[model samples]
Target: MSFGDIRVAERADWLIERVATAGTLVLRKLGETRAGEKSVHRFLSSPYVSVERIVETLAARTALQCTGRRILAIQDTSEINFAGRDKKRRGFGPAGDGKTPGFFIHPVIAIDVESEAVVGLVDAEIWTRAAGRVTSRRSRAIEDKESARWLSGCQAAASVLSDAAEVTMVADRESDIYLLFARKPERLNLIVRAGQDRSLADEGLLSMALAGAQPLRSSVVRVAPRGPGDKGREAIVELRAGTVRLVRPATVRKSEAPEDVELTLVEAREVNTPPGKTPLLWRLLTTHSVTCAAEAENIVQLYRLRWRIEQVFRALKSDGLALDDSQVIDAERMFNLTAIALAGAIRTIQLVDARDGGPRPASDVIDANFTVALERLSKKLEGKTLRQKNPHPLGSLAFVAWIAARLGGWNCYYKPPGPKTMRDGWNRLAATLEGYALATQHENPGIP
Candidate 1:
């Protein structure tokens, strides 16, 4: 079916609507009457509507309202663990766990760093291999077909992002090692935290170049905290500056490594911390030239934007969707389940963008359609015990859950017998609240 023809059902939209509070389980429960688990599953699993499209849609809508520089693309990965089994499956990648197995979700997210608004999402696979003792005795076995296919997932993701207006790949030390960034296609510029003692060619000392100059020593530098860094809050280090000219890049001793490229090393102050704190120093390397202090400062500011991905990760893992809640039995099904949850999270973000009233809400914005559907659901359960005792402010599911959890009847730990338990729970709650509403109306009919 064409995207335009897709119907916005009362139940589906209701599920989407509650995603902000009740989360995926509530959405699935809300969907059970109008559509089965399979239907909700299909809606989430289909690739036609992806996080990329959702972000792009928001970007396009925002673009019509404001204008700015070309887009800046940032790429990074996060680890999501799986309960280990003897073997792995397609789309599951290694997660750096030496023992228990896991997968990597490498997302290439683009944003207007200036605006802090995300505009695109591209995910790739990084499959894992069992470490020593988990697999065969042979130490250097080539990957079997199941794991080898992730190479294409990586390349395909890169190919799609190759055309971004301007691309900058950011990562921790893992991505800084020579192979991943240095060997990446030249079109991509990278800003990564470097590993200590990585190959380097420091040009002849600047004092040596200038006659009768005293040798340079450590200088005092002030470190100022900017906003949060990729890891956490960032600080700037300032020192007596000097420049180095590079004639050749540092050579890699290993034959398997990529060829070297030229880099200039300039040293500055020793910025140490209190007795409990460790000293800080930055030995930065980049393909871009640093002609002035302002340029150097901009690079550090840009790297700080890497923290934005952390927020996205939180949104996927804990913010409402709880993508990790899936109970799928195996790797393929687990990955498919993860992808579905990501779509739900992405949709929730879009819905919030559509409804957020500034930084806070001044009044109710739930549409008439959603309000009526909720009322209908409440009416349908009037005869049950869970009548609208004190119908939730605007009758939101979130408010209902809060009430149930406080009223001593709702057990988050309760395991329902089957899929029907969700609908039954809501019906019960509605019946109680509705009855209360009726009693109050009868008692206070003349007051209002």
Candidate 2:
């Protein structure tokens, strides 16, 4: 079956409304009226709309935008637990905590490597674990375990980003699986942090090999802020790079997989750390070659983009959309709503990314109907000077971002606007667009 045009319009309107409301999952706030709320509920509860189809629609859009770009397929898993409301929830099993009623969402978001702009969602893995005692890792295959998300994510990236010049699958330590390397998709690159000390093909330990290698160089790296009022700090880190052969663990169930895989290892060990704080260490394994310090640093920098997924989590959870506070009692509807909220969270982040001028088009986050209104709003915000005026071209993501930041109350006097300011500005813009459209239709019945 295909997604109907009416369904597309409804979802598009929902995306706009969701961002305007800071990703709230409540139907009451999203609908704003009894009829409106019921419509939203019906949309989510519709038997015709499945989670897979919803995600596939978004993936198709992402594929179109990623053509001829170096794409980063960043994947991460986040839990959505209903805490005390687990009892009332139906169709939900034990969450990560083993008791809460919720499911997990593992989503891969495509980002333009050069522009640092969001492309769109590629795939999402949403599932609920059955209530039972789990088998040991050695007894279960990667396919049967939660760890298969990495391989699935890579395959999805390869299929969706086939037109891209280059594609790299990046993730944290939990993704350091041998099957991922042994059975990687064609032309798909990987950058995963090592999680455990494994045997090397040369009869040596993996950690000792990197530690024994000479330091490549040192550089300063920015640490992300922990929360509000906490400006993150930077630290000087020593770099080390080497190529090592990794032996497949005996515990792995896939006997047909390769016995050994050769990959470069890049390590960044922080020096002169602040008191009471542990030093930062990153053991990155990648398919790309790194023979020089510059190449090693490049790999490290790319891995830093993994933080984007972390920000997405913040937006989807307590900071932006409070999915846990959702009033939905059915697990299926909640899962469907989660997919939309995930996209909305990314949309909010995209606006934040464009607060300054950027290369992405505004269509990345808004439809064409709002372009004229955005232009009029831009005129109202622009001053007489170049610095006072918008720096990005019209119809660009950055152009729309400047309007959002200004509407959010940035004076062009202080630090650039953050996520909160961007979301607030977007909220105001959404309201303004609705009012403008209504007023336009009222005064001129022919204008749509």
Q: Highest lDDT: which candidate? A: 2
Best by TM-score: 2
Report the C-alpha lDDT of model 1 over 136-224, residue by residue, as the tens digit. Answer: 42333223333222233234334555544555555544454444433555655555555544433343533333223232433333334
Question: Candidate 2: what lDDT?
Answer: 0.84
TM-score of each: 0.53, 0.93
Locate the minimum summed-lDDT window of 10 residues in model 1.
354-363
Off by over 4 Å in 1: 1-22, 25-27, 30-34, 42-69, 82-95, 126-164, 202-236, 239-258, 264-280, 343-448
lDDT of 1 at 329: 39
Candidate 1 global TM-score: 0.53
